[model samples]
Target chain A: MSGLAPVPDAEHESVPIGSNDDVVRARQLVRALAQQCKLSLVDQTKLVTAASELARNTLVYGGGGVMRVGLVHRDGRVGVTAVFEDSGPGIPDVDQALTDGWTSGGGLGLGLSGARRLVDDFTLQTEVGGGTQVAITKWAR
Target chain B: MLKIGDVLLVSIQVELEDQVVLELQDDLAARIVDSGASGVVIDITAVEIVDSFVGRMLATTAAISRMLDAQTVVVGMRPAVAITLVELGLSLGGVRTALTLEKGLEILARRDDSRPAQL
Candidate 1:
């Protein structure tokens, strides 16, 4: 999945995750793009749910951020990618943050790991004092 | 929302935002106490996705209802949502679910019948 990029003229949108309503909008935007990608119903639901988790993390843990979504094509296969960037206290332990049922906030600790499981590709980049950026993609079968 | 017999019904028809979900939880808890209802049925037929935050709200609402002496049943979960939820690793062990609103009410009714009569 590395080096793959969005189709030159495909649709792209960005939604800010500043509040709960923004999170809902992010989910709606991802759902629409996933539909445009012609993902199956199950795949669409998975991608939207993953987006929801990440958007909430951007708001609750990251103290607000933005989600950028686009449609990517590779090898004749179409996919949707969402990138969540937040400039909050970066995760000190990426591995622990990805562990199931491990949370630094008042959550079920399933956000990061669970989102990873629902997508085709997942990437996490963070620094102790910098920020966190999570990129995920779901390709249509 | 509706009240039928001793049960309260909440049908979620919109995409649930985090604040709305939290408000629903608080409202349901208050309504349960005010009506002294014995069962609560939450219908989510219109919901297309169930993230961990929403999943946690359902579980937390059920627990609150149980503490209020009311059985809570979530109904009308989409198949895709179910599949995604399992893959997301949230079984919602503390909450009860049914396929439809009628079945949810039935489950609540059966539980009521099985309970020993109070003096």
Candidate 2:
């Protein structure tokens, strides 16, 4: 971490998450942005992996949505941020959704919790029948 | 897909889509039988991510290979991918893994060498 820059730039890109192919596209977008931020190999892998998990969740569980990737400079370090949004039937329990081994789909139930562990910061908000939003950030160290 | 010394080698270099993973499972299964390979080494060095579906496919492939008399060794898993797998609660149980392709082949060769000779 270095001294904070007076002005930080946040480069952003958004992609739809309608199908399985879109999930891979989101991963590619985030991977490029993470590289632009100059994050280390491990950091890049973590962010991209997290993005993959979340993107899949958005498509399969949320019935499709959009993923936004951004490169952010804050706290004296550059980082990557991803936000996933879906307008399908939202989760009824945020806590349960974040818990490991809790999956409504036929999966290993590691999507949400695993993504959280891979990133530096995570936030989730959902309402029944409304939609779901998840934000994750990974800062270069 | 490549075969060397009765071992099937697959190096996955791209971000695996869900369908691609499934196709891999089918192809590997068929190749294992067609080639009469006793060992299978899937090199994932270039693979940056392994979601639950892909993880399950690997494990399933390993299990199926064993039934067909081939030992499956998944090699070159990145550190981040390993961490994410654990966090995702997928143990990839029953799947053997190695740090490198050379090591993966060595494990298979050892198994071959240790087997009893037919009378």
Candidate 3:
């Protein structure tokens, strides 16, 4: 909670993630937000890449979902966070899914873990037959 | 896309859908076969992002081109794209990379020049 931005005040935007185009748009939206927040180039790339992976997972694994992006300020540092949510079949094992080279799809198996490594903060919540939500953040440095 | 000397130059300037990425792979491979091109220079400077999917496609295309006796050189990778790619664990293996398109062409020319001319 220390790193969480003041709730109910930060500017937030949501993008629908249903298709490839949606995923692209999600990345673009996140990139613009990170840029607006004055994140360094590398920091922006990390956040955008994480957004891309999560957005793709939302589409391919969850059968489509929604992405929420917001500018955040924590510990006197500016940052951005993106939340990916889906109501599809949830992950049976969140730990396993976060492992590198673990993939339920035909991808390179780097989406989840790699994304985790690129960002400053990460959180995931899921339940079998319930849903999945992943939130990631990167603080500008 | 532009063909110059024995090298094919492709500038990716748009946010490509997955299908389009696949199509580009096919088209580049086919063109390499048909034109007998010795090299391919891909410029991604205008690209805003390099997701894992695009990374895989690029590496796959380079592998295919090598099989077709064509070398592949990717050029103009922005710093951000490079960082993202590394963070994503995509090293773009088997693909030669250059800092700029001009350097990429020079690399291909040097390799092509060193080869014994097939009369």
Best by lDDT: 1
lDDT of 3 by residue, B1-119 (tens): 68998889999988877888999999999999888899999899988778888899999999999999999999999988898888788888788999999899999999988999889
Query: What digit string (tens of lDDT, one per residue) describes model 2 on residues A16-80?
Result: 99988999999999898888888888788778888999999999999999887787777688888
Candidate 1 CAPRI-style tier: high
Distance (Å) between predicted and true CA of A52, model 2? 0.3
Question: Residue A56 CA error for candidate 3 (Å)?
Answer: 0.6
* Per-residue accuracy of model 2 over B1-115 as CA lDDT, tens digit each: 9999899999898778998888989999999999999999999999887877788889999999999999999999988788767765777879999999999999999999998
Docking class of 2: medium
lDDT of 3 by residue, A31-63 (tens): 898899899888888888888888999999999
- Residue A43 in model 1: lDDT: 98
* Minimal lDDT window, size 10, model 2 chain A: A1-10
- Interface CA root-mean-square deviation for model 1: 0.4
| Local accuracy of candidate 1 as per-residue lDDT tens digits, A60-94 | 99999998898888789989999898989889999
Most accurate candidate by DockQ: 1
Candidate 2 vs 3: which has more TM-score:
3
Off by over 4 Å in 3: A1-10
For every model shown, what is its TM-score relative to the native structure?
0.95, 0.89, 0.93
